[model samples]
Structure formats: structure tokens, C-alpha cells
Target chain A: MTRLRAAAALALAAPLALAACGGEDDGTVTLRYAFWDDPQRPALEAMIDAFGEDHPDIRIELEQTPWDEYWPGLDSQFAGEAAPDVFWNHVSRFPAYASSGVLLPLTDRIEESGLGTAAYPEDLYASWQFEGDQYGLPKDWDSIAMVYRIDALEAAGIDPSEIDDLEWNPVDGGTYVEFLQKLTVDANGENALSPDFDPENVVQYGAAMASSTGQTDWWNYAVQNGCELQNEPWGDYAVDAPECVEAIQFTADLYNRWGVAVPAEVTNQPNGSLASEQVTAGAAATALDGSWTLGVYRDGLEPGTWAVADNPSGPAGSGTVINGLSNAVYAGTEHPDEAWEFVEFLGSEQAQAIAADLGSVWPGVSSLNGRFADYWAGQGVDVSGFQTAAEGTTTEYPLSLDDAAFSTAALDEFNQVWLGDKDAQAAADAVVAIANE
Target chain B: MARLGTRYPSSTVNALNPVVDPARRTRRDRSTATAYALLAPSLVGFAVFLVLPIAAVFALSLFEWNLLTDPEFVGLRNYRDLAEDERALKSIGNTFYYVLLNIPIQTVLALLLALVLNSKIKGRNVFRVIYVLPWMAMPVALGVIWRWVFDPVNGGLNRFLDLFGVDGASWLNDTAWAMPVVASVNVWQYTGYTMLFFLAGLQAIPAELYEAADVDGASRTHRFFAITLPLLRPAMLFVLVTSVIGSFQVFDTIHVMTAGGPAGSTATLNYQIYLESFTQRSAGYGSMLAVVLFAVIAAITLLQVLLFRKRTVYDFS
Candidate 1:
């Protein structure tokens, strides 16, 4: 009887023991981190490597979803309760995720960890807060600037320095249009100013105005023209103001009326390339792009052939659309402590330095921001213009509770505005109604 | 001859001994049992994969669920919402427009392609494989390549047009051109697939009929109308039914290429469903859209079946 009981117990315990082991017999926790930007992968991998050395009990897995499909895919994953342990979150998406109770409340965790919030930019850091709870830590910052090709400028016989102070008004596009017209070369080797210049068969475009996301394109124009994106934070969209409408019309005229920029057919919503991609491909001479895309240019363009300059001064003076991404922990994450640990590491100055040294983007740690410019200087490209934009006038992308709806609605309406199928004021009103509904 | 409602059409039930009762009945019982056993796996699969999800979608349509929150029973509210939804209505119209543009042209082209390839032409086998290549490719990848080909300024189509001093229109971004461009892509990808069915259907028609036509001194057009056209019904029915259904559910190509834009000209119902479910996080409304899509496709399929049943002969054997 005793012998039989022993055998039975052994049979039952065998599978139990195997199940208990569960692939991590050493007790190492594997945290899945998801992000959308591919260019920032190396810096992120380096952060993972650095984190792993100090905490050998933790391992990290990185998931890279492209920007085009990222939010939609992430929404599905969140709905299915299968979101990554830690993922990059945008300000536009934070309110809905936080309000829906899908984001892990990090206030207690951040407080318990004794991590300093002073290292982060105040607006960006606070943007992730909801209902008196902190949900994310600022990871990086971005400011818009003009990414221009030096050869294109030289060929047009226009000095590159001349673009820094270029001013514009909604009525005539001011000196900015004239400056771009110089760089707009025709197939017959004549610029836009020449009588022989033909807009139909242009060999090279002067500028690329990406009408998809005006954050780095026309939003600056709107903000400089003293237009607010919304009535208030977490409020209805207010881009239908006359100043905002004029700014949008001016941006369109660059492609349609002035014909200096690349046409909307290839540079507007739904099927357009990024402004940075257009400049990198030499389809256009210059584009107003964000600091996050600096690495794309460094890797894409010939070294020392491209340089950055401050955005042109608008009617209300120069302004960059300042935005930043934060590291957010999914509330559904199985390993909450480890996910918190990873986010805390990402927010630290040490990790920020590692990211900064690569010159991919401005570091979240304010003290380390200048190091990003230094790294670019070492690469033979002066990127201080980005710093100037950041230091000078700036505006945040509109804050709202459910920007996913707004973004979809705006893309549909503004696409027509960019295509010249609908007027700016009408498109703005349509988008606002649909989004607010 | 085997008729429609008969059992044991080939006499396989009692091949060795015909004048038996008890033995034959026992064998028949065992055969019926065996047939049930053979069909069990696939029947189970059909119920689980198709029937269950469809039932779930219908149930989901009655709720107000966004996936992140708990579902609330709204009971026909989503349907009510659909009535007022402008985009939803537009998407339905857009899908019909796309099907009208795509199906007829693709079907006629596929038939012609199969007929030509079936003839005694040089390199016909190579042509068969070449035509099917687009069908075999990934639709998303093909959409990307097509986008490059249709780019307004730097596209091959425009550059080609420029050689003759005729500027090509902005094919994918123009409201007038967007639907046609997207529909053309569907036609391009699936025409060869449709052709394969027609080719098989053409081959199945014995050459004896054509020889008989030749003996009667029938013209090519007369033979096609009198014989070839009538005989290819089964394949035509299969291609037309499946192609129309596939065209109605086109999301990947539109998602990758136009994203239902150039001012909502290409926004089909399926794309709108994805937008509502995934982008807007309104899976309840999305499910209602899905149910509507299922009903539309099912009604059309039933219509095709009823139309074909009277004319189709299944027992060519």
C-alpha cells in the first residue's frame, strides 16, 4: 500500500514540478517594450543592455510597430488585454488610455522609487497626469526646424543663412514663397522666377509641405498666426478661427498657387511620404521636420551635405510645435514591478545620456539636452537651430480626451483641404463637428 | 443517368451482388455511418470557425463595447446609430460603386484571357504562369508598388505620359480617379485567379463539341454562344460569386494604398469597419457594420445560387 501511494504521488508531482519551472527557473522576468520609431531602436537596445547588466534578473524584449499602423494596432492589443508591458505613449493618446483605466497608475511607483521629476520638461512630464495620478514619464522631446540640402541651396545661388529669418504672412506667403521659388527648378533648367519656368514639368521642387500632420508643417504657421488648436485643454477643437484658416490657406498656396512646394497629389494625406522622407530622397530641397527625424536624415542623406535651420518667422514670429513621447506601463502587464523598473531606468539621466550620445533626438533629461547638439556637431552638422526653436516660441499639439477620433476625422477632412477639393474653413468645421460628436 | 434527388446513382452500394436485401441494408447502414465519420472533422470546423464567430458578431452588435471597458447592452442602438452615420452610409455606396467598376471588366477580361491561352498559341503555358503572378503576390506589397507607379510627379505612368506631352492625372489622389485606381488594382490582382477557373472550365468542355460545330459550318461567335458560353456556367458562377464577395470585403489594398481617402472616395464598408473597431475603438458599431456586410454578401450569394441552380448541370459525369 505504501509503495503504491509513493508511485501515485510521484506521477502527480512530476508534471507539477515541470509546470512550476515555467522557462525561467532562474526567476528572470521578461518585459516586453513596444515603440513605433525604428530609428531610435539602437539607442533603446543600448538602454536595455545597460539595464540588464545591473539587474540580471530582468530581460527585455522590444517590439517595433511602424508609425502608420502603430496606434491602430496598439488599440486592438489594448482591447484584447494583450498590450506590451511598457510602451511608448504620445500626449494625444494619453488622455483616452488613462481615462479608460488601461494605463498603469505610476504616481505611487514613481514616488516609492524616489526618481526626480525635475529632470523632465515640465509640460511634457505633466501632460501624462490624469485624475491626480501620474501615468507616464517623459522619454524625449522634439522641436520643428527646416531640414535643407546644402547642394540645393548652393545650386539655387541662395545663401543657406538667408532662410533663418525668412518671414511670412497668410496673404502673400511673404518672402518665404519667393525664397522657395528660387530653389524650385524646372526641367528646362530655369527656376520659378524665370519667364521660361514651367510648373508642369518641374525637375525639382523647392519645398515639401507634408499636409498630413500639420504638427511640423502648418501647425507652426497657425500657432505663429495666433491660432489655438482647441478652445481649451481637453476641449473641443478650435482650428476654425480666421487666423488658423488663413494659415492653412497659406500653406496650401505653397503647393497650389505659388507652386514652389511639391504638389498635394504626392505630399498630402492617406498616400503621402513624410516631409523628412521627401527631403532625404531629394524630391524637394527642404522640409520642416521634427527633431525625432534627425537620425533619419543623418542615416539617409550624404554626411555634411544637409544642415538644419530655424523655422521661418511667421506673422507672430517664429514658433515650433513642441511635442514629446513618454514611456507608459500597461495596467494589464503581468510583471508590474519590472515594467516600472524599466520605465524608471528610461527616465533616468544615465539612460538619457546614452540616447543623447547617439544624437537621434533631444534627451528627456533637461541637463543632457545640449549633449544631443554636441553629438550632431561632432558629426559635422550643426543642429543648434533645433535648440533655438525649442528655446524660443513654441506650442504644444492640441490636448484632448479622445484624439484618436479627432485624428481620423481630421485626416479625412483636411485631406480634402490639402487636395483643394474643400475650402479650409469648411473642412475645419466638418472635422470639428465629427470629432466633437 | 443520375438524377437530382436519387440515392446510389452509380450502384456502388451493391456492386458484387445486386439481388440482396439484408446484406445490402447492413452495408448501407455502415456506409452512412462511415460518411458521417468522414465529414465530422470538417463539419465541426465549419461550425466553430464560421458559425460561432458570425453568431458572436451578431450578439456583439447589440452592445456598446469599446474593448477596454465592459460591454453594455444597447439593443439596436448601434443599428440606429448607423442610420444617422454619414460615413457609414457613404461607405456602403462606395463599396457598391467599386464592385460595379471592378466585376464586369475583370470577369470579361478573365474569360477572354482563358480562351486565348487555351488555344494553340506559342508560349501559352508561360503566359498562363505570368498572368497568375500578380494573384500570387501579397496584396499589401502590390499596393505599395502600384502607389509608386501612380505617383503624380515622379511616377512611371506620368513620366511615360510626358514622353507624348500628355500629363497623367493624379491617379490615386483625385476624387474622380481614386475609386477607379483602387478598383483597377483589385481587377489586376484577381483577374488571373478568375482566369484559372475559366481555363479549367474551358478544358472540361470536350473538343468533340467544337468538331461537331465545325461539321455544321458554325462561325466562331455562333459556336461560343451556342456551346462554349453555355458550358462554362459552373466556372463562371463560381468566379463571379466569389469575386463579387471578395471585392465587397476589400480592406488590405485600400488600407495600404489610399486608406479610404483622397476625400473618402475609396472608403469601402470593410475599411470603415476597421476604422470604427480598431481606430475609433467602437467595436460595437464595428460589429453592426460587419453584420450588415455579412447580410449583403449572403443575400447576393443566395441570389447567385438561385439564378445558377435552374441553369447549371452538376452531373456532367
Candidate 2:
């Protein structure tokens, strides 16, 4: 009788346990928004709070990942049909996502939200569009710029005005190289560029050529020199082209032939913090860093030491590579409407103004340029040159989701060139081989 | 039957029983057999986990699969690529160098520590525990601590060097020092574990022999060579074999310390396999490297066993 009673009890408890595990039907909608920028979290949170106040019926979840891990994580999530409703996208990575049908078309959303196409620059908007469908709404934009030590330039007896009229063409920019050489002084009484320059006793370098981030500055030169990274419609690798090789060689020569820049071995040292720690330690006079580095340099160096300038031109023309981040809805999102609504809110004038005010990024909308410039100027940074450089961009590469594999292969091949194991031409050819394969 | 028993011998009658006829057993008889029944669970486990997975890995190695897509068969291509791969070759060289660094240092240190503890020392157990503490710590945690200690800037090693006005070198970043630093950490962690084995081997050596050597006026070093070493040959062989295998398979420290960087200076074969499989999404190439590593390990282990078997003197009597 006791066993019978226990069996009946067990049978009853099974359904109760199952019921506890069952999914609930809450009337409130949940939206998942993913992004990679930790520095911009406060602004994003403020924007989301405003959106939440407007729509109390919706609940939003923020998924934050570091930029390196972001795309791969998103790719795996999309593959598993578990992607967030909205996520940050980049111009370089958008094409691969759009091609894979993972991004939701935002054409109708953009039209319906009353955010006219003209509000954002056409090229910026077109960068996020592919195959007649807009997959991403521009969130922010940026371009390459020269970051230099203002005091160092003045102390070296070189006028900063010399860089103002610096005409850059694809073929030759010897003047800019000379300027860098003149400004680079061995303040520690150790000559770094003279005939008696001690490689071991290098107290100061003239400039640092950025190499860790895929030789991005070199790519800008390549584009200016009439070398396309890929053929139109993004079909072929053009890194092996003579023009691209020249561009790559020119940047590599800054370290090798010119002796104006530090050795790649020293600058590329793993965990060495070469640029931030060593460069800001007053060891390097200049660095060809991204505009985003304004924040890093400001935090790293003493006040009134640095200023910004346009990148020198090559023989082809003066060029800058424009890149930006965008917000896109995941195609497999369960709450597509809610995701689109959030994306529209992100693109709104109010949100962009808030973003501009925070000085986090250059807001994508053209009308917000004044707000962004004023914000930076108020922070004691000269950002007027950045606006001009962004406007003068001649080429840009779409950051592909496959950049993890493609970039690793390319970087490994290029490391040989930096290490003096292979020439620039060979490195370029090797990169093409690896990328296409 | 009683009459037959009366007529036959007891031994003959016993032999005629059905239990004595082993060849005539049926399926049910075999199922009821004790030995086979006892081993059934272990046999099933071995078949399911070990044998089956090894077979599957062998099959997988012949295909080009990235886990995201269907695997396509491409026989010997992965192997061919492995031959030409400069990175894989460099890694192989690095792995051998690690083995060379680890085995001798670890074995000698372990033996030396065991000998010191075997003496008439107070608080011997306390010393043993202190020495073995590194082995007890989690490897990942140990790696993190070591990374800080070996850090080029603001590190313990650098600060220690600064006391003597010696400039601190980039221990983890400099290619020349990176592998040696990693090897030194491995030696530090494993010496105590190996020392335990040597201690056990030393304890088993009969005290009478050492007394005899002492009576002969043998020096401590001479006694160690004549009495202790010969008896500890088996322990030395065990240490060498295990240390060599462990060194070849080193991944964690290298992964944490370098991630095979500073121009691929410290990349080992195992690290390369990880990079190829996970980082590059080239599973086919990774599996090929894995197969090669397995073969190399197998060959080395077998060779060591054969070489050490002849050298080891196990008799204490």
C-alpha cells in the first residue's frame, strides 16, 4: 500500500517538475542589442534608457563583447539561429554579413523612420548598402590621420605649417618623410639616425609606422597610388599589384631604408605596448595612427604635447581610407519589428546628438558634424583636419567577417617582410595567395 | 549410476562430470561464465569511448572539414601540406628543444632533491610539502602568476634584477629568452612531482648496501654512484620517459606566454595544431599535424622503453 502510494506521488510530481521547466508566455517583448564598444557603453545605456521610457512595454538586453571577439561570436550565434535582435556592424564586416543573408534589410525601416538618406553622407550610407538593399544604418564614421607631438615639432625647429600645404601623390612623398626625419631628435644624446646611430641605444625615433592593425596606413597609401584592395564587386585580391607592392614597400621602407622609423621587430614586440608606452614616453616624435587614437594618446601623454594632421599623399593623389560602424538587425531575430524600432531610435537625431556630445565617435549624420567638431575642440583636440581627411577619402575596404582568417594569413605573410626575411613584392604575392586560397 | 561408481575409480568418475567438458558449452553457458561477465562493463566502455573515437579521428583526418560545413574527402593533401609548412617544421623543432630542456633539468633536479631529503634532516615532510606545492596548484592559475612574474615591465624578475642595477630584458617577448623561460617554468612545476617518484625509488633501496659501501670507506659521491644510482635506474627511466612525453605535448604555458608570437619564435607543434584548427579554421591541416605528433610521440616512447629496459637494474635482493 505504501509503495503504491509512493508510485502515485512520483507520477504526479513529474508533470509538476516539467511544468516548472516549461517556457513562459510574457506579454512584454524582449529585444537583444549587441555591440562591441565598452567605452561607449554609458552613452549607449543612456540612449537605451530614453528608448525604454518611450516604450515601457519592451524590455531590452544589452550584449557587450570586445571588438576582437565580436564578429566571430556573432557569426557563431547567427549560424546557430540564436543571434541578437540588433548588433553593431562595421563597413568592413558588413559586406560578408549581408552576403550571407544574416543581416535584415533596413531599406523600408530607414524610409519609414523619417531619417532621410541625405541626413547621412551618401558614400557612408552606400558603404553599408549592398545588392540594392540597405543592411546597416550608419552609427559613426572615422578615417586615418597623422598624430604628432606638438612640442617635439617645435623644439626640433620645424614649423607645423609645413604639413598644411603637404601635397601627397601616389608616387612620392619625400617631403613628409623629411619632415619626420627633421623632427625626430635623440634628446638623450644618443644619435638614432646619424652614421653613429646606435640601434641598441635608440633614445628617440622620428616616427612609428603602424603595422599591427593590418598595415592599414599602408593600405591607404596603396589606394592613393591607384591600387584597389579588391576588384569592383569585391571579387579579387589586388594586393599583389605593382602599385600595392610599391605602397607596401614604401611604408616598410620607413623602417628599413629611411631609418626614420623604428625597426618592426622593436615596435611589433608582443605585449611591449610599443606605441602607447614607448612612443608616449617621448621616444617617438610621430605616429601614423587612426583618429580613434586621439583618446588613447590624450590619456597616455602629458598635456599640450600632441596635435593632428592629414596623412601625406602619394603619387596618385592625397587619400584617406574612410571606415565606420553601423547598426543592423539580425535576420533571424524573433522580434524583427522591435529590433528595427531600436535601430531607428539609434539613428535618430536625438541619439546622434547625445553620441556627439559624449565625444565617443563622429556621428554618422552630416548635420551633427558641428556638434562632433565642437565636442572635440572643447576637449582641447584639433579635430578640424580629421573632417577634411574624412571628406577626402578616396578608397575604403569593407571589413569582412572572414577578416579573422584573411587578416591572420595576410599578417603572417607580411611579418616576413618586416623581419627582413622576404621583400615587399614577395610578401604582397604571398598575401594574395593566402587570401584567395 | 551407483553400480557404475562402485566399478569405476573416484578420479575417473570426477573427470566424467559435465562441468569438466569446456568445449561443449552453449551460448547461455558462455553468458553465465564468470570472467567474461565480470569484464563486460569495462569492455563496453573501452569500445564506446576509446576505440571508437580513435577510429573516428583516423577517418576525420582524411577529410577537409571546418565543423561548420560538410567534410569533403581529400586524401593525403593535408599530409602533403604539412610537409611544406614552414610553421609546422619550426614547431617541431621547438617541441624537441623543449624536451631537451625539460628532461635533463627535471630529472637531475628531482634526483638531487630526493637525495637531500633522504638524509638525516629535521622536518623532512615539511620540506617535501613545500617543494611539491607548485605541482598542486592549478596549471592555468600557475600560468597567470608566471606570466606576471616573467612580464617584461613591472615584473618580479625585472624588479629583482633592478636591485643589482641590471637592465630587465623582455623575458616573454624576446625570442631568444622566451622558450628558455617557458622551459624553466615547466621544470619548476614538475621537479617536485618527479622528486616524489625518486624518493619512493630511493626508499626502496636496501639500507644494508649503503652500510656496506660506507664500511668500504666510500665517499658520499662515490656511494651515490655505486649504491644509489644503480638502484634508482628504474625511477630515472620512468622520469625521462614521462618528462619527454610531457615536454612534447606542452601547450598551456606557450599559449599563455606567447600565443606563438614575436615572429613565431616560440611556436610548438601542439600550438600550431591549435592555431590551425581553431584560429584558422583549417581542421584538416590540424588533424594531419596531430597525426604526425602522435606518430612521433609513439616512436620516441617505444624507442625510449627499449633503450631504458636494458639500462634499468630492478633487483634489490
Candidate 3:
């Protein structure tokens, strides 16, 4: 009986033996900063190292999760009360995390630190808020544009300068479609404009759009063609508008009817991005992608091969979808003071300038915009198109409760339309039904 | 060194035995204590990792939680909601379809491979290793490679088809073909692993039984049915049970390949549970689905055990 008692006691004490190994009292506070940008990691690390210089008593750890895994990984960590002291927050995801009280409200901290929002765009600053509590400090802003092959356009007997003024309408598709057809080549070496152009044996498409859902693709077209996705921030989704149907139908026709865009079957093969991949491989002449994709393009293609231009103007005029990433602190952080200090430093001129020089994204601080443009120009890539588009009338990617559910449903329904299994109108109705339900 | 007298009656032998040492009871108790001490670590680990989580899943099923907010006690509400959820219902049906597509074909292929390897052939050991190698590779890596192979436009599969004058078809992207493609990939990965068990079972069967069947004027096919198959019941049951459980829990490959897309044709129950919990933040509803899944797997396993209880021939000697 005594031996049995001793065995039971030892068994019960096993986990305690393991637990005792954790959390020794140390004078130095270690803070974990989680973010998802691989290209910007070096700049971020430099910023962190610079912050560590002034405060040697504090150490910062970088937790890099890929974009798709970041949200779920952070959610699980938050559930276990072990989320990083600081992490990147997206505007679309801010509502869910901020409302759940996993994020620390930064309004009071911003005031105490004398970090005024006057230097940031009002919408960008407001994007990280939930119910009037600032939950994020603006990091960077991104907008979409048309990235095209310069040599392909020049070889097609078209002036490269004409790209900036391309226009389109729902019925005629305007000069933009004409330019597309000129660039699109069939296997017989005939351009799409030729009557002999065969869709089945196309060697190169004129343009490509990502098959998946994002503000950078058809959603941008939907808004640019005069569809309102939301009545308010985090409000009802309204994709059933006539303008939305027209925009989606036109985009789908680029693949199914005109055969000028890469098929979804090719574009959505796991990790493949049709727009970027096709353009890089010379399978497509152009892509309508975001400013965030600029680094990838520059890294993959030669500097003189591609150039950026403003997206084609629809009947309603040019429209861009603008979104930003924000730095947010975990509400359950053990080192709130240190985390806030790092987040504050991240918004300062020094960190923003470092981020600007990286040329990966447009720094959220409006004053650093010229510096970013200069950095891109130094790299021999003109980014004036993205800036011009951002300055125009633009739509915000809506922030909603459980946005993933709505977005996933939208992508599933839209994929049917993209595959020619359903019409745009039916898909739009399905998206609206799912969103409303 | 003492021997008990044979003259003593059997009933009184134990009581009258002087050979029993006085410290025997204490020695036995000490050995039992040592055995329990050795078992303690694993028992604690099992309770912590497996038992507690299952209990927590069951408890969470009766509540409404979004993980970020405080859990509210809402008895049976999640289960009730699950009953009406069209997506959840579809995923349940899809999971069954995946199991039906995977198990029989995988088992038959594995058995055939096992049988071929059991025969006298050149480099049979090398072939055995080659067959099991796919199962050893990471599931994530396999899914990635297969996604490229099944790519509709630029994939190797399409290129191979072109050589035969066959028009390439949309594979993973097509709703009709997506589930089958995913099932085939899984079957390809697991067939070798299941083959090892069948090989062991086949080798364990006595050659004398076949000789006896031959003497009874039975042919090879008749001997296989009347002798080989009856003895192979144990391996079949094991393979079927494991394959069903594995099919029910499949998530990573589908997540990487289809992401439960092309109009939700490939969204199995596990994928639905993941979407509900992690993606949608409806952990409570996800727990309900997980509980339902547990109930289903448990019932199926129980049925198989009951059906095989008397049919299995364990006394091969």
C-alpha cells in the first residue's frame, strides 16, 4: 500500500517537474513581435536592432508566420493566452480581433507618447480602430495597378505611352481590349485581333488575373465598375448590384469568351499565381496586380521587361482598392510597456524610413511617400502609377465580423463562374445570399 | 531447496507447503510497485494529451464560444445548429464519399502488391522498400508535388496525356474530378504502408495448410478462398479499421490541394471542423462536429470488431 501510494504521488508530480522548468525571473524583458512579410524581414530586423540599442534591458523576438497561417496561428496563441507581445494586424481582420479583446487599445498610448495621427492618412489611421478604440498603428498601405510587358507592347505596333490612358466600358471594352487583343497571340502566331486567331491554341494570353479572391483582382473591377461592396464598414455586403454583375461578367469573359486571360485551372494550382507567373514565363503579356507584388516582379523579371500603369478606366472612371497593415499589441502581453514602446518606434520616422528604403511596400506615414517613390525609381522601376491610383477615388476592402466566412464563400461561388459552370449573375446572387445569411 | 511431498492432498498442498518463503508477499508487492512506477510517465502523458482534450471537446460542445469571448453555456444549441447547417451536412456526405472511394481500392491494391512481393522474385526486398517509401515522405510535400503533377495547363500529367493524343482534362480544378484525384493521391501514399502488414500476415500463414488443401484436390484459387483468405481476416480487419479512421481525419492534403473548394465538393468533415473553429472562430460548433465524428468512428469500429469476433481464425497451429 505504501509503495502504491508513493507511485501515485510520483506520477502526479511528473507534470509539475516539467512545469517547474518554465519562466525564471529575469531582469531583461523579452518581447515577441510577429509579422508575415518575408521580403521586409531584414528591414524589420534592422528596426528592431536599432530599438534594442536605446533600450538594452529589453529584447525582441521575431515570430514570422506565413500570411495564410498567421491568423489561425495567432488565434490559437490568443486562445492559450500566449500570443506574441506584438503582431501585424490587417484592416479586414481588425474587426474580429479588436472586438474579441485580444488587441490592446492604443489610443491612450498614442496620446501619452505624443504620437499624433496627423502624419498618417485619416482613413488609414481609422482603419485600425474598432468602436472608437485605436487597436493598431499604421504600418504600410497598398493599392492595385496594371503591370505590363513593355517589349511586348512595343513589338505589337503600339506606343508604350498609350498604356497610361487605356479606357474601357461594359459594352465595347474600349481601347484596352483592343490593346489586349494586339498582345494576345495564338499558336499560329496570329494576334487575337486577327480573324484567324484560334482561342484553343493560344500561345500567349494578353492578360491574367488571379483566380482567387482578393481586392487586387475582380473585386477591384467590381468596385471600379460602380458596385458597392458594403453600405458601411463592417456592414451588409451588396454584390447583387447591377454594376457588380456587369464587372464580374466582363472579367469572366476575358477568360471564357475572349480567351485573353489565363484559365482558373492553370492559375489556381495550389501555390501558383497566374498573373505573376504567366507574365514572368512570357505566357501572358500583362497582369492587373497590386503594389505589394512589385518586389516579386522586380526580383523575377528583368528591370526593363515590365512597367507599371494605372488600371484601365471603366465607365465610372478609375478606382483603386486601398488597404494597409497595422501593428497591434496583444491584450494578454506580459510586457505591455515594452511592446508599446516597440510599436511606437515602428511608427516613428526612423523605422518608417528603413521600411521605405526596402521598397517592398508604401510606408503608411504620408510624409515618407516621396522617399519610397525615390527608392523604387533608384531600383529602375517607376511606381508613380500606384501613387496616382491611390490618390484617386478609391474603395476600402470592407472590414466585417468573421470576414473569412464571407470571403471563403465568395471565392467558392466565384470559382464556379470562373470555371464556366455558372453565370456571373447566378454567382453574384449566391455570394449575396451567403453574405446575407 | 525444499520439495513438497506428493502424498499431501491437492487442496491442502498450498497451505502445507514449507517451500513458500515468508517474504514472498512483500516481494510480489515490490515488483508490482516497480511495474506501476514504470507505467506512470506514459499514463500521465496519455491523460494529458489525449484524454483531457477529448473531454474538453465534449464539454465545449455544449457551450457557445468564439475563443475570444467568454464562453456561454448553451446546452445542445451547437448540435441543434449543426443539424440545420447545409455546408456541414454536405461535408458529412463528402467525408463518407471519400472513405468509400479510398478504403476498398487501397486495400485491394495493397493486398495485390503484398501477394506479388511474397512470390519468388528478383530483388524482392528492394521492391518492398520502394513500395513503402512514399508513405515515409511528408504529407505536405506529397500534396505540393501532386498539385503540380495534376496542374491542368502546364503539368506533367497533361503533357503525358498529349503524347497519347488524348486531350488533357482539368484535374484538381474540376468539381467532378477533384475528390477522385484527392482520393487517388491518398491511396497512392498509404498502399505501401498497408502492404507491409499484409506481407507479414501472408508470410505468417503455414505452408502445411496449402499442402493439405492440395491433397484434397483443391486448385490454387480454391485454396486461396478456403484457406488463405480465412486466415487473412485479422489483417483485413486491421487495414480496414485504420484506413477508415485515416480517411475520416484527412485534412492537410485537401487543405493544400483543393482547400475544400470548386464549390465545396472536397470539404470533408475534418476540413469543415477546421473551417468552423479556426477560420470562422466558431469553436463551439466545431467541437460539436468533432464529437459527432468521434461517435461515428467509434460506432463503425465497434461494428467491425463485432462482425469479425467469431470469424477470425487465431489458432493457426
Top candidate by lDDT: 1
CA lDDT of every candidate = 0.85, 0.73, 0.83
Judge candidate 1 against the unseen true structure and give its global Cα lDDT, from 0 to 1.
0.85
Q: Which ranges of candidate 1 are over 4 A from the true structure?
A: A1-26, B1-49, B313-317
- Evaluate candidate 3 by giving its C-alpha RMSD to the native, one decimal: 6.2
Error of 2 at B310 (Å): 6.4
Better of 1 and 3 by TM-score: 3
DockQ of each: 0.35, 0.10, 0.34
In terms of docking quality, how is candidate 3 classified? acceptable
- Residue ranges of candidate 2 with Cα displaced over 4 Å: A1-38, A48-87, A91-96, A100-118, A129-134, A166-173, A187-200, A231-233, A269-274, A328-344, A398-406, B1-63, B66-86, B117-219, B222-245, B291-313
**lDDT tens digits by residue: candidate 1, B32-107:** 9999999998887676556655666787788776666666778999999989998899999999999999999999
Off by over 4 Å in 3: A1-26, A269-274, B1-25, B313-317
lDDT of 2 by residue, A214-330 (tens): 534577778667787776545667788888888877777666666667656555433333454446877788776665556667778776678777777777777777778788999
Report the lDDT tens digits of candidate 1 across residue range A1-437.
23432232233234334344545667888888999999999999998999999999999999999876888778766655667899999888887889988899999998888888988878778888998999999899898888899999999998877888898887777888888998899878899999999887787788987744578777988877888888887787887878888888887788788898888888886468777788888879988888888899998899899999888888888888888999999998989999999999999999989999998679889999779989999888888888899888888877777777778877777777777788888988887888787
Q: What is the TM-score (0 to 1) of candidate 3?
A: 0.92
Docking tier of model 2: it is incorrect
Question: Model 2, B1-317: lDDT tens per residue?
Answer: 12211256678888677474455566547776877889898886666545654554566567675433345678988888877788789999988988888888888998899999988799999999999999999776887788779765456988799889898876765678878888899899999999999999999999998899888999989988878898787777778788888889998887766667655777889888877765665666777888888899999999998777666534445
Candidate with better lDDT, 1 vs 2: 1
For every candidate, give the share of true A-B contacts it also has: 0.56, 0.07, 0.46
